[model samples]
Target: MLTSDQEIRELLTAARTVAVVGISDDPERDSYMVAEFLQRQGYRIIPVNPRLVNLNIQVLGEKPYATLRDVPEKIDIVDIFRRPETVMPVIEDAIAAGAGAVWMQLSIVNKEAAARAEAAGLKVVMNRCMAVEYRRLMPR
Candidate 1:
């Protein structure tokens, strides 16, 4: 697991594409807001939400994929917004999709899932907001 500010900042710097798992179509949601912020900061945001995919809805101008594996593109990071108990499947998908890292949003932490991701050679960041970290570490 990556815990240091320098490590996290380096990961954020190297990352290009992020898959936002469990993202909501509603703009008011934190998931949506963070994804938008990352997008505006020049990171490619791939919204991952099965519900939105089923409804043929787009989030942040990109169609939401059902899962990370369904993205059909290289994903640098998987930004998770789901509950802690539900993170295992997303971690599995991230590993299968060959993602470089998995980031669990604020208040969402699953040590088991983090371990699994790390074992699969993926960096893990738990209980932190990507937008907050980006703003803090990569100030304009």
Candidate 2:
């Protein structure tokens, strides 16, 4: 079954940290916007992209990891920002990395990948924007 808004909100609220796959350095990208949004909401945002190796520490903080395997802390959620065809490997990596949930960004679709994660005991949320859910569910 596809994840509900309630489930996504619960996951986001409970998750202390999130690893963003396919994160881009370009400020115009949605990935960067979402990452910054989550960070402002008090979630630890770790950028997971191989292309960021050349970036400075102050810019990337902990230096972007090439994959989930390179992340230092336990990942609560793996927010994917890539194409549908590019998400399977990231999902597999999330499971291997011991992530609690897999969140595919808005407009992105990957049912097969979501099912695989669900089967692996990881909560899966697809085709949704986490930032939207957070605002809708936690609008104080």
Candidate 3:
């Protein structure tokens, strides 16, 4: 784990635009709730999911990208909601997309992938809920 609260706080403070990879169109999903909360907090939320491509849909008012490579702008953070085994490719994509950080949502952790992302110069936050951390670390 990246054991620096101050660092995490700083990261959260610096990040204004987040690409929510694996974000769901279903409003009841955790990914949706978290992304929604971030949007409400003034962050630009970019949803990414292959299903969106199939269905021609968007999430939370922003158009969904089929992949990180499909996004046309620089992403401050790549917030992952996929399973552990599916993370490596996403990490690689995040790196290729020039993202500043990779945030794995609650209960998701891939040490090897995290290492790779960190080695590639991107901050990694794993096994934590971004929304929870944001509420705890950032003052309103």
Candidate 4:
């Protein structure tokens, strides 16, 4: 797992495209807030939410894809906002989608899924908010 300040900072610096799985359309949600923040930081946000996609709701000015595989562009990171029990499938999709890293938001942690993602050669970060890490590590 890449949890060190330097490692996280490096990942944040190198990452350009983030696939936000389980992103919500509501602004009150952390997923929505984080995605919006990343968008403003110049990282392309690919919203992945089946419900929003079905409803034709766009998040952060990008069409929400039903899954990571549905996204056509290369994904640098897969940011997950789902529950711990539901994160395995998202990790699987991230590995299959060829993402460089897997980031599970705060309060979400799955050791087995993290192991699987690491085995697939993807950097894993569990129980951390990407936005918070960005603010802490990349203060301007």
Q: Per-residue lDDT tens digits of candidate 1, residues 1-140? A: 89999999999999999999999989999999999999999999999999998999999999899989899999999999999999999999999999999999999989999999999999999999999999999959
lDDT (Cα, tens digit) per residue for candidate 3, span 30-128: 999999999999999999998997898978999999999888999999999999999999999999999999999989989999999999999999999
TM-score of 1: 0.99
Q: Highest lDDT: which candidate?
A: 1
Off by over 4 Å in 1: none
- Residue 90 Cα positional deviation in candidate 2, in Å, after optimal superposition: 0.3
In terms of lDDT, model 1 sits at 0.96
**Residue 33's lDDT in candidate 3:** 98
TM-score of each: 0.99, 0.92, 0.97, 0.98
Better of 2 and 3 by TM-score: 3
Candidate 2 vs 4: which has more lDDT: 4
Question: Which residue ranges in model 2 land beyond 4 Å of their true spot?
Answer: 54-60
Give the clashing pairs for model 4: none
Q: Which pairs clash (backbone N, Cα, C closer than 3 Å) in model 2?
A: none
Name the lDDT value of residue 133 in candidate 1: 95
Give one digit per residue, the lDDT tens place, for model 2 in 52-85.
8556432235468889988878999999999999
Better of 3 and 4 by TM-score: 4
**Which 10-residue window in model 2 sums to the lowest lDDT?**
53-62
Question: Model 4 over residues 36-61: C-alpha lDDT tens digits?
Answer: 99999999999999999899999989
In terms of TM-score, which candidate is stronger, 1 or 2?
A: 1
